[model samples]
Target: MDTPTEVLHRVFGYDSFRAGQQEIIEHVVAGGDALVLMPTGGGKSLCYQIPALVRPGVGVVVSPLIALMQDQVDALTALGVRAGFLNSTQDFAERQQVESAFLAGELDLLYLAPERLRVEATVRLLAKGEISVFAIDEAHCVSQWGHDFRPDYLALSELRELWPEVPRIALTATATPATHAEISSRLGLDGARHFVASFDRPNIQYRIAPKSEPKRQLLEFLRTEHQGDAGIVYCMSRASVEKIAAFLVDNGVDAVPYHAGLDSRTRAAHQAQFLREEGLVVVATIAFGMGIDKPDVRFVAHLDLPKSVEGYYQETGRAGRDGLPATAWMAYGLQDVVQQRKLLTEGDEAHRRRQALHLDAMLALCETVGCRRVMLLDYFGQQGSEPCGNCDTCQAPPESWDGTVPAQKVLSAVLRLKRERRQKFGVGQIVDILLGKQTAKVLQHGHESLTVFGVGTELGNAEWHGVVRQLLAQGLLAVEADYGALVLTDASGDVLRGQRQVPLRRDAPRPLRAKTAAAAKSRPAAELPQEAAPVFERLRAWRAATAKEQGVPAYVIFHDSTLREIATLAPSTLEELATVNGVGENKLAKYGEQVLEALTA
Candidate 1:
């Protein structure tokens, strides 16, 4: 029998385990239960996969996304692993074949959706076969308070009840301390050993820009920083997804729209295209990207704000999964704050409170003047991290000035409007009043004569809007649920009096589009030596054709990282090619000669 390290190199083409992987694998192989909190792209799959291969029976994987099961199986199959999935998408005959393989002990791993376990037939089917281990991927979904809660995951605790002897491992890419505890409790893994990996992804540079013609800003960001790269653009609404996708396509980008609103077939086709093709961008709502295994996504841009810091981290974590430099960018503004606040009003008191806490944490991250990475890590209960010079704040530190006077000016304007005029207004009117703009709305209200009007002319219209946004973020200003008009919070009293000093972050002038630290560290083929570029392109072309022929993603044949190593080494023999990191035995024996021919030609 092959050992785990040997199996790692022979099948998956890695020379050694990533940090914290070896110990976890050893324990699971020894029949111990574990809960793993590793970040995305941290080789969480290998922790369970190697143990499954070395153990006696098929590993039963409980996955959340049935739609992605085929791609997952395809990826493993390319490595010469006998992998099969039983999901609703498969026909009865297809399910029967996988079942037979499982029963015959011919399959290495069998993937199933969590809901499938509720079926009595599926339970009986599992009872008929031996299970080496149970891996619950995306285990954070079991947390009722988490961003992506799936009711089906709550039933996963029964796995331990049914198969008391089969060791289980639950894995997730994002979880806070609270969510971690909840996962343990809900999944009945409280006694299971826990391994929490560092949540930092230094390859991703975090950036948040104040929204200014956001679609245009997104387009400029794409064209300038991430041209000809695979990316995901997240929007809060389906309409925004469609409009942004169309806008990008119109502006000479190869982009597609993905949301729950699309038909299943259309969504699948778009997802397949994104995985198979290069330089494609998918503009999607939050529904699109939970289990995406694509590793080359260079950037994740948010056109609107995410509700929670955990959700934001989870979404941005999807980028730079290959450990190459990538970007986590967002366009945030006053309306995003208001919209999210309004959303919190729905649901029960407990639900509203939980969502409010989430929103508050997210707002704090957006408004933070320190390192975005540090704030992100702190939210996940990791501390003592020095400034990561890759985030926008660290790269270009913003000035924080005493905004107490400006705060008073803005608050006075709102106060006067309410107490004197018995009227309320949203941000636009408030900013106009602050700037002393004699717009029709102001004149119709009959008087630019308020004491606070024109007091804020020391700042530009944009600057006044920034003050309002910051005040809202700081909780001194609240949005009325009925009409989103500015209302004062209990915290507003201190600033209204002279008792509080409000220090606010000044929005820096937009910098020139130049190579950021993250961009400079990127190792794309474009950065390869001049001679190797063409060879890399040739290999990419060959791989594309082969993937099309085999009906699988190009990465399944070989990752771009592996090909880059091959292009750099210019290996002349199969022996030399096998030395590459991702060149496994199966791939070497299958495509070794063709790779050499492609390199030489």
Candidate 2:
């Protein structure tokens, strides 16, 4: 029997285990349950993969997405580990073959969707076999309060009842304290040992700019900071995705659109291209980028605000998986906050408050004057100190001004409208009244007579918008669900009566060209050295060809980081090449000669 360390170094090719990984593996290998919370690129897979290999029998992994399962199987196969998956994509014959392999003890790992466990035949088959352990990936999906809730995952709790002795491991990249508690209870792993790692992705530089011509801002970000690099441009709607994809293509970027609206064939084809090719952009909606195994995404740009901080963290975590520098950029404004409030308002009353809280947390992160990383980590219940130098705030701290007067004006307007007119007004009407714009609504509502009218005329529309947003984030303002009207909260009274002060981030005027140029200078170039350029390209060509022949993503063959290391090191023999970070025993044995030849050429 191979030991866990032997399997880690030999099969996965890592010299040492990451923090919290070996302990989890040891706990599970000893037939104990565990719940692991690690960041996206923090090597969560090793925690379960090593235990599965070291334990007695075959490991069954419950994954959510078909694409994710296929990618896992391909990567495991590349490591010379016998792995198979059964999904809707497979025919009966293929399914039967995998089942036979499992029954005959010829497979090391088998991947299945959570829904498959509900079938009597599948459950019986698993009961008939000797199973080492059960691993639930994306375990946060089991929590209804989680951003990505999967109904099928709720059925997974039955596993504890069915196989009481088999150890189980639940792993996720994003989970709050509440989310952690819910996952443990729902999955029947409340007594399991809990392992929570730091949620900070220091490699990703967090940037949030006010949304002014968002498409233009996104294009500037891409052109200046990430030219010729692989990235994901996320839009809130499918129409926006289509428009942006076309616009990028027209502007000389090789890009594709992906969303649930597209047919399966088209989505799969576009996903394949994005996975197999280099320097391609995937313009997608929230429907995409869950468990996408691509390791070298250079950036994740949000054209709109994500609904929650959990969603934003998970999406941005997709980039910089190779532990290299990456960027997380977003352009959001007041409209996003309003739209998200509307969503929460229309949701079920049971979940409405929780959803609103999540949105507020997201807004706080965006409007925060402190380090973005600190705010983000704090949301997940992790204490973060020392402003990370990678984020936009740390790089160029935003100036803060005493916003007490602005807060008074906004709150007084809300009060006067409610007390005198007996009506609630949305942000647009409030803005109009503040600016003394006697429009049709203003005239109809007789808001011109209000004492707060024109009190904020000195500030521009954008500045007032900023004030309103900051107020909401600070809990001084609340949005009425039914009419999207802004209302003053109990906390607003203090600010209105001069008992409290509000400090808001001052929106400084920045020249587009100068800002873009500075950002471009800040970003590192994604290029190989002059002398190693030829070898890198050749290695990439070889990877592309090999992936095409095997019908898998190129990254599954070898990550770009590994290829660059090979090109730079110019390893003349298999033994020297084995020292590379990604060169595990199986990979070295399988591709050693070919890698050496490529380096030579």
- What is the C-alpha local distance difference test score of each model? 0.91, 0.87
Query: What count of clashes does model 1 give?
Result: 0
Error of 1 at 97 (Å): 1.2
Model 1 regions more than 4 Å off: 516-523
Which candidate gets the maximum lDDT versus the true structure? 1
Model 1: how far residue 39 lies from native, Å: 0.9
Pairs with steric clashes in candidate 1: none
TM-score of each: 0.97, 0.94
- The 10-residue segment of model 1 with minimum total lDDT is 514-523
Candidate 2 lDDT by residue in tens digits, 421-531: 898888888888999999988988788889888888889998899888888777888888778899988899999889999999875455223235444433332356767
